[model samples]
Target chain A: MPAGASTRAGSILAKPDHRYAAVSILPSVLVVFAVVIYPLIYAVMMSFRDSRMGVLGGFIGLANYARLFSDVEFRLAIVRTLVLTVIAVALVIVISLGVAMVVNERFRGSSFIKLALLLPYALPGTLSALIWRWMYDPSYGILNAVLYHTGFIKEYVTFTGDPRTAMGAIILAHVWKFVPYSAFLFVAGLSSIPPGLYEAARIDGASSLTIFRKITLPLLAPAMQLALIVQTVFAVLYHFGLVYIITGGGPGRATTTLPWYVYSETFRFMQFGRGSAAAVVLALIMLVFIYVYLVALSPKERTVS
Target chain B: MRRQDTISGRRRRKAVWLALMTVLIGMYLLFPLVWMALSSFQDERVLQSRPPRVLLTPDIFTLDHYNFLLTGRMPETGIMVQAMYTMSGTYVLPSVVNSLVIAVTVTLGNLILGIPAAHAFARVRFRGNRTLFMALFATRLLPALSIVVPMFIIVSRIGLLDTKLALMVIYLAITLPFTLWLLRGYFAHVPRELEEAARVDGAGRFTVLWRIVLPVAKPGLIASAVFAFMLSYGEFPFALILTQSLASRTMPALMAGIGYYGSSRGMVAAASVLSFAPPLVLAALFRRQLIDGLTQRFE
Candidate 1:
């Protein structure tokens, strides 16, 4: 055959393969765009208009955002959300690190202990919160019962009834559900640390605490950062089922996080625009927080990669 | 002698600290679960007793609560059993089935779609592939609430509202990205030389994937599937927002309605225990896989 004929044949053969690849990936891309991107744009649009489900009354740009800022409950919800996220994420890190260390040590029944600790994570959040709710029930709860029995309190401690304790209760519930996940990450980090480092430290007469502070903490930074980012997002987005099951964001909206607030505004009050604005604010907050952390950790991730 | 004494003393102190920490953690983790089980067997009057009695031992337990839950009426309260029966009959069992069906279907769907997509991303280095994978990962950063309203509208318009299919589709959205990203890492870790040798032996790409790549990546695949299953089983927001009927309601939603919104302590506890059983069993069976799935490389 002539060179021109051969080139034409090669091009014809490659056309089908290129088309096949494009066809193969198209469904997934379309699904993601429909489910993820379109919603995001819709949400942004909704935030700017006086809209309900099908009622787009008028466009009022930034009015919803302004109302969100001025709304007392919304502002309080933001503050409460931050407090919940920080407290829950911080406690999870500390406690899960401790659990991971214990589980990491060479011991019998370690696997069982780890599995037991992880049970809360596997259970539905609502179920776990409900169980905790039962335990926090002032009238019949085991917590108050135990406290009173132990002479720690003369009166019953209303864990979810008192404002001060309501937030703490939710935080405790969040930590319980998430600690195992964090511990799982920490264990991975711990295992990645070569045993030789610990041996060398011991030979250098380093105490366990010293080894942990100098060697383990630094080595575990990546895992810690991942856990921090993930947990912060989860904490901020604490949903209705758990909060509703426990205290319904009360003893007076004490436990109403951003996600719960969005639910109430959209579903309860039927204020779709205001709700979308709150959701947008929430997304921006998460984006800003995660962006700062990513920037801070970029050099480290690059080095590791 | 003095140095020896100091070293022994230090070792003893560390042991004591470890023991104390272990006990505290054990109590914190186990007490609530144990209390729930115990409380489920207590009489309603005993539950409301001013001084809450320790019902830890089985001797103090009454079958009344369990009987009430199973029979749909608490004889002591004289409350009509209709609400309880309606909830259990209308909501509880169907929701469990809904959750299981949705979870299994979504897990299978993710495996089917994600594995191929992951393979394409990992092995077939086509144009814009890196950008595609990053975009997929970034999709996860979008909050579930952000998309839920759109999904609600989409489902309603498509006439899938209050349907298991809607729940399944929503779950697929949530699980697919992580599935693709995680499986891509696993696929990439499989040695390219093996595939190359298979091709040398006249095996096609599909044949190499089936015979060589898949068997090597079995652990990672199992881990991914388990993670998908666990996530689907425990998911709430989509289920709550999408499904309204008994036939489509999920376990988490049912539990929320019964335990939190409604007043059925014993039945809720029973339902919770039952709801928790499947995931706990799965986690037990694939505990190692779960850890690996979460922390393993995403390269």
Candidate 2:
């Protein structure tokens, strides 16, 4: 009788607690605001001013932006970064889509393939870059050894050392590490597509390629768009580790992509003003793409609706 | 009868072709890692030889690399522990510990803070909720490097530079948005009927959340936890800026250190193997959950 009474008493509660929602939400919101949003504003402001060894110098107005425009190295970095993004993102999309399509077939070993596909994405960028660096070692590197043994070449190719190949090598590593997530996303995208569509196409005597083009690819558009944007962002901004580890932006700054360029300029050269300016320019460029994509997509959405 | 035979033959051919394609793709994906692992088990002579030795003899194979790292006793020959320090100032074990601590702590913090916040957004239609959520979501668009300099200043001014706490805080900021976004969808999918029924029994919101919501959201919670752990484990740019020495430098930062050292490929390969092991194991174990979490969207 006492235990039953206790159980009944324990079941009773306070009010619905509307305030609990605010209490739960506010801390994370504040942290994100302080850490992400505030620093973004700070970075923008810092771009407009001069800074020396972490010291904020007097406001230089638009000089930093003006200087970034005139700077050849900065301009080159923009082009190089764009090329890297295009190639890496394109490769990732194509490879991942193919892999996703295959793995989604429910073959006997499809699960193992899926797991292997995600392994590279699971690795940290630093470790991935590190592993690739060892692989690219010209002297004792396995790549060269394999090439030689396969009768592909007589001499060991210095992949990261050669300017022509440095960016390519980095892009290959980037694609490898990033393809898994994109593939998995594509897999998800593929699953969302109704199987009935494929069945209808097959009944109409559609070939596999035609079926894929007409049904599968169209359905995967949204996922493809998301993956492209995310990959572009990473390819441009977050590839610091790969370049830093593999090439160190070497072979006469051949692979000195924007992030590495920013690091070298700011920390290595102590030109924090220009560094911030470069960062701002990069950010603005991304915003432009996003804005353009959204503007382009909204009209289409309206027309379809 | 002839048509049926042709169709069966074509199906068999297709199966063979598919099998071949799978092998080719698998090789492309696993080759680098397989090579890295194989190289790690070999000593310097076997590794440094021209036309790199794909097949290692018993004499060529050595546990010295792992022994040196795990036990801290130098090998009789080949690479030494001193080589890593002199070459690039890298210390493997401590950095591994540091990485583990940072990754685990950041994951915990994300779950604690992000889950409740996600719940708030998911369950309650509070005032300014959309605005707040939009603001949080918008932060994801900002490039990490854009705010990097400012983050450096913020960390240093607080006198937390080169500390694990700084990495944890920065990683928390890095990971929270994704976790909240992912878990919010999961939390919302949890049927309101369950909570409504629980509430009818005089249970409060917290009780409903603890009793009903969490258990249903376990897979999502686990996936987000792993995401946070991986992101923190692999993060480099912020770690590069904030950490000073091996004391606080995570595994990725140590890789950068080894890059500067540039001499001992064997040692670097060994370190790479160690770093790769954890994520590889975790991935194999939780691949299903990760796939579900990543592909999850508003149904």
DockQ of each: 0.47, 0.56
lDDT of 1 by residue, B91-210 (tens): 565677778888999899888777767776778756787788778777777767766666676788899998888777767877888888778888888989998898789786667778
lDDT tens digits by residue: candidate 2, A66-155: 887898988898899889989999999999898888888778757777877877878788878878877888887778877888899889
What lDDT does the true structure give each of the candidates? 0.75, 0.80
Report the number of the highest-TM-score candidate. 2
Q: What lDDT tens digits, residue by residue, belong to model 2 across residues B1-299? A: 99999989998997897798789879988888888778778776667667677776787788777766677666776444336423332477778888899999999999999988888789887567777786787677777778788888888899998899988988898889889988888899898999889988878778888889999988888888998899889888898889986667888887778734435556667778888777777777887788778667433
Candidate 1 chain A, which ten residues in sequence have the lowest lDDT sum? A1-10
Residue B215's lDDT within candidate 1 is: 90
Clashing pairs in model 2, backbone N/Cα/C closer than 3 A = none
**CAPRI-style docking class of model 2 based on DockQ:** medium
lDDT of 1 by residue, A1-305 (tens): 12343344545234433443455456677776677787788888889998765465699999989989999999999898888878889999999898888877745445655766767777778788888888788877777877888999998888888998998988888888888888878887898899999999999999989999999998988888888887877776544566777887788888887878887788777788888888888788888878987888654443211
Top-DockQ structure, candidate number: 2
